[model samples]
Target: MRVTRLLPAAAAVLALAGCGAGGGTKAVPPTATGSLESLAAEVKCRPNMQTDADELRQAICANSDGKFILATFATDRGQREWINDAKDYGGYYLVGRKWVAVGDDGVVKALRGTLGGDVEVGTNHSSHSMHGGSAHSG
Candidate 1:
């Protein structure tokens, strides 16, 4: 019958949806990657203020002057795409192989003395490219 045929298709759809599904999204702290300690120790950030899901492993940091977010990516290419895409935003960015520091002028300038990477001051934050995936084999 029609009901029986639809049941299998509905079950298939549910199975697909279950892939990569989590119970719920969880927030990631600045220290999640253990890199937050290093940055805070070096820059004297207060080691507080975190937000959102762990999609980017993001954390907000503060010092005497201001605050910024340190976002960690799963790979170097992930970091690079974000930085490159952010050129359109024009705000300040301190990028490493796996992390990026995003903030206004004061916060970025505060850490500039010790950190190294491409930087710019602007007003917008463009979205990073995550769909351009590549495949490999070993």
Candidate 2:
């Protein structure tokens, strides 16, 4: 019957529409990657060199958003270690593959628009004396 056929066609159309609405429009991740200067430029910041070494490059940068510390590591291990130690101070970090932007939450979130990184929040410890307690992992 015409009614039976229309019902199945309508159901098929709805199913296809649901697929597109749910997962077909996944946002593409930001792929911008580069050195301290290039990344800073993308975010419209003038970097003031802080540390220049074989293992890492760091700079202090400021823009209309705010000031932030931008650092790039020579290796993934180096970057992770630096983040682990720095997390004790409690701050917001916009992290990429080999680089990280440390700043207040607002500034860090603003940086993510241009830098395309994950926002990580550091744990703030009032007392540094954890003694032998288990370390917190993100």
Candidate 2: worst-modelled 10 consecutive residues by lDDT: 17-26
- lDDT of each residue in 33-136, candidate 2, tens digit only: 88989999998989888677777787777787777788888889888877776675667778899998887766766677667778888776644557866466
lDDT of 2 at 94: 84
The C-alpha local distance difference test score for the whole of candidate 1 amounts to 0.50
Which pairs in model 2 have colliding backbones? none
Clash count, candidate 1: 1
Report the number of backbone clashes for model 2. Answer: 0
Each candidate structure's TM-score, on Cα atoms with residue i matched to residue i, is: 0.51, 0.70
- Provide the lDDT at 109 for model 1: 51
lDDT by residue (tens digit), candidate 1, 1-138: 111222232223223322221122233223212365676666677655343333345556656545566666666765565556554445566665566676655455555545554455544423334465434336
- State, as a TM-score between 0 and 1, how close model 1 is to the true structure: 0.51
lDDT of each: 0.50, 0.68
* Per-residue lDDT of 70 in model 1: 65
The residue pairs that clash in candidate 1, if any, are: 90-122
> CA lDDT of 31 in candidate 2?
52
- When summed lDDT is taken over every stretch of 10 residues in candidate 1, the lowest stretch is 1-10
